[model samples]
Target: MELVCIECGKARRPENLFPMSCECGGLLEVRHDFRRADAEKLRALFDSRLALRTGPYASGVWRYKELIDPEVEEAHIVTRGEGNTGLYDCAPAARYAGVRKVWLKAQGENPSGSFKDNGMTVAVSRGAAAGFRTLACASTGNTASSLAMYAAWAGLRCLVLVPPGGVADGKLAQTIAYGAEVYGIEGGYDIGVRLLNRYGEELGFYVCNSFNPFRIEGQKSIVIEAAHQLGWSLPDWIVLPGGALSNASALGKGLLEMKAIGLIDRVPRIAVVQAEGASPFHRMIASGGGELVPEPEPRTAASAIRIGNPPSWRKAARVLRECNGVTCAVSDGEIMAAKRVIDRSGIGCEPAAAAGLAGLKMLAEGGTIGRDETALVVLTGHLLKDADAIRMPVPGPALEPLAPDELLARLASVR
Candidate 1:
């Protein structure tokens, strides 16, 4: 497998794959030799396992392994059977907002309870194949837990760097329980990023950041699976809570590949959703340049989405203009409200998950989506992953029924 520089169109072998862009500093995208005929030929690889009526992995994502080059071809995927998560048609959540057919891509079903499992499956799969003894990432929380969980499954050493006071106990517990070396950094996520990057280079550790092309390769299959789930039909739009921008960008690449293979006729407009407190890409959309505007100090309950400087900024911008898709930011209050709102609808999710739902609601109100349009809103991780970050109005423990003469009666009844 090889990649071509998107800038100079120069091809290089995978062995010489540079994790970041070259002298021009352009974000790299993989180039495949699979032309028209190969696209149609791609699905046959998983013909025996294809289950078209259900989730896409039952058909496309897992089927498109030819397009993705894993480092260890012979190594079994380190999935706790992560992919093929059930998609739900959220009737109650949709009815209140005049939404027609809102489907939730609940990635929370993954082993560590998040979509990070998808990328980790590929990361751990490749790391094992490539003979790497160590794997690491700098994360807000979920990615670290995912990396650690999958590394443990693959029997590889896992190193995690996270922001101090930014992570929730549930998240920290998950990572530590997986036996990863958890380092709580005094700085922010981006600072942790630089530290991890330099650390990877010095220690020869395989990085699991947004900058890693293979990690994105694992993400692309999400689009493939989504398409297959809809019986090879593409949705009108895919909404996601954007932080690193790799997820949306990779989804786009996956859709285009499917179209190249004639599996889908069109690409969905990929809308990137962000929390208003740290909407850096929203600023880029307003400024009319791919260059990210300086991000403001963040404040939001959606701590995982508090990314001021996303590394995949430029490519994310290209996707925005290319598809004419727009970026939308939702207020922290609305995100919190939506968290309650979704829970009321029996779909409990974190604030970042709520942010995506809020963004979708905003788009629907603004006529960005037609009432009949099919939409897939991704809830990236589980609410349990960061339950502590959400602010409740009042602290209350579980209550038993109050007696008529409560204080005295309860004292007698308590015994």
Candidate 2:
């Protein structure tokens, strides 16, 4: 296995403490050597592990370890029952989006109540195996929670840097509760990440951000597990909300691997949704797919996706083009409306997660997505992650003490 630079195609051994970007200043991705493995035998092995029900096989990510990283020792594997999130059949969400069939992959059901757990489990495990004493990341919210939890499980010191007053209270509470040393930065997530990149080596900390290749490898299991849940059938479309854009790239990578191995015949088109206030990727797509231009001051009510510059833009853009995918930006109002529909269906998620549903509705209305085709929307986080975003109830009658006869009369009149 080797780490390949996405821009210059330079290959380097994965030996450094934190191998984030390439010498060419581009992102790095893990490249594995596969010499035409038997697809049936591989599928049978994965299926057989499901029946064992213990150790690494029970983990949704580790069960596909051969595809993720074949070199990692079994003793170094770290897990917390992550992955295996439910693929829910949501008829109400289908009706709302005007689709014939819809499935909501509830990633919030993971151990940390977000999709970040899928990546953190592998990243931290690799960090531990590399003999790192400390793990760190600059996060908006979810990443902080995940890193802290995984680091705690691995018996490593954890550090998190966040934009002061930028993270949601619930997520901030998770990092603190999980025993991570938190630092407040003057700028946003992108700035914090830059600071970590500059100081991480000197501080002896392994970076656990999306820029890490192992994290991307672990996140690939989300699509892999989703495909397995559907009985190896590929959906017509895979829709997800994009923030740092790592998940989109990982999903595409997983599907392509399966295609190459004859596990699937065709790759599903991907759809990435971004909040209007923080839509650098969507803007890049709108601008004829040229070089990405960062949004200097991204602002959005969805705190989880309020990123100005995504590190995985190049990888994600390539996947989007290869999959013939489309990108769209939705307003906060549209996201909240769609979230209400999801909440009513008893499959609630955070505002950022709801952007997928909102985008699906827009695409369906615009005829970009056919109503007769099957689609899957990925919900990235739990509803309680952003409880403050929940709308308040409408004003009602004032409370007042009254006699029994008067209360009876008022109730009868209202009825």
Candidate 3:
């Protein structure tokens, strides 16, 4: 395995504490020499691990350890049995998206009630192996909660910097409940991230943010496991919300690798969905592509994706280009409408998760995505992760004591 700079093509050995970016100021990606890998044998091996009831192999992220980080020793691996999330085939979701089939990859089902657990396990494990005493990150919510939970389990001090008044109550509570030392920064998520990048080394803490290559490696398992569940069949498209763009970049890397290794015959097209209020990535793509201009004050009710200047934008842009992907921004109203449909289907998700479906609907209507093409939408967080974001129904008149006959009459009058 080698750490390769995405832009300069410079390769280096993986270090105990690798810098966030390459010397060329480009992001580093984990690259493994899989040319000699036996595709069928590895596929059989992965399938065999599904029967194991214990240890790292059981983890969805570690099950593909050879791909994630082959150098990490088994003893150093820290896990909370994360990344066994299920895939749901919902009819209502399909109808709403105007697609023939829709599979919702419920990443929220992970232990942390968000997809971050998948990446956190690998990142924290790497930190523990490197003998780090502390882990830190700037988060809107999900990343903080996942890092804090994993850090507690790994016996490492965790620090989180969140934007003031930006996190949902449930997510904030989860972060605090996991025992992380939390700080509220004056500005937004981008400002908090800049602070971490500038001072993380001086503070003597390992950064667990998505900009860390290991985090993206673990997140790749979302696409890998999804393909496995579909019998190694490639979907027509994989749609996901773009926040820091870590998940989008990881999905592209995983799919391309799978295609390279004959795990799948073709790479699926990717669609990145962003909330209109926080749509820097979408705007960049829509404007014929250039250097990403960060949003100064990203506004969105989807707190999880309320990031403006995502550090991983370059990586994600490359992925979009390679996979023939498209990007779109959806209004908050559209996001909520799509969320209601998924919620009514009994597969509820947070607002950010619904952005993918909303974008898919738009694409379908715009004639970009065909109605017959199969697509998979990844829901990054559980419904309760941001319970406060959900609007409550208006209360009806208070009920009075009623006789059995009166109740029967009322029931008969109901639909």
**Candidate 3 residue pairs in backbone clash:** none
On the 0 to 100 scale, the lDDT of residue 317 in model 2 is: 93
Q: Candidate 3: minimum summed lDDT over ten consecutive residues — where?
A: 392-401
- Full-model lDDT for every candidate: 0.73, 0.90, 0.90
On residues 275-376, what C-alpha lDDT tens digit does candidate 3 reach at each position? 999999999999986889989889888889999999899999999999999999999999999999988888899999999999999999999999999899
Runs off by more than 4 Å, candidate 3:
394-412
TM-score of every candidate: 0.88, 0.95, 0.96
* Overall local distance difference test of candidate 2: 0.90
Residue lDDT tens for model 1, 263-347: 7877788888898888888877867765687474665678878877787777677677666678899998878776776667666
Superior by TM-score: candidate 1 or candidate 2: 2
Which residue runs does candidate 2 get wrong by more than 4 Å? Answer: 394-415
What order do you get sorting by lDDT, best first? 3, 2, 1
- Among all windows of 10 consecutive residues in model 1, the one with the lowest summed lDDT is 53-62
Please provide, for model 2 over 90-169, each residue's C-alpha lDDT reduced to its tens digit, 9 standing for 90 to 100.
Answer: 99999999999889999999998999998888888888899998999999999999999998888889999999988999
Better of 1 and 3 by lDDT: 3
Which candidate's lDDT is highest? 3
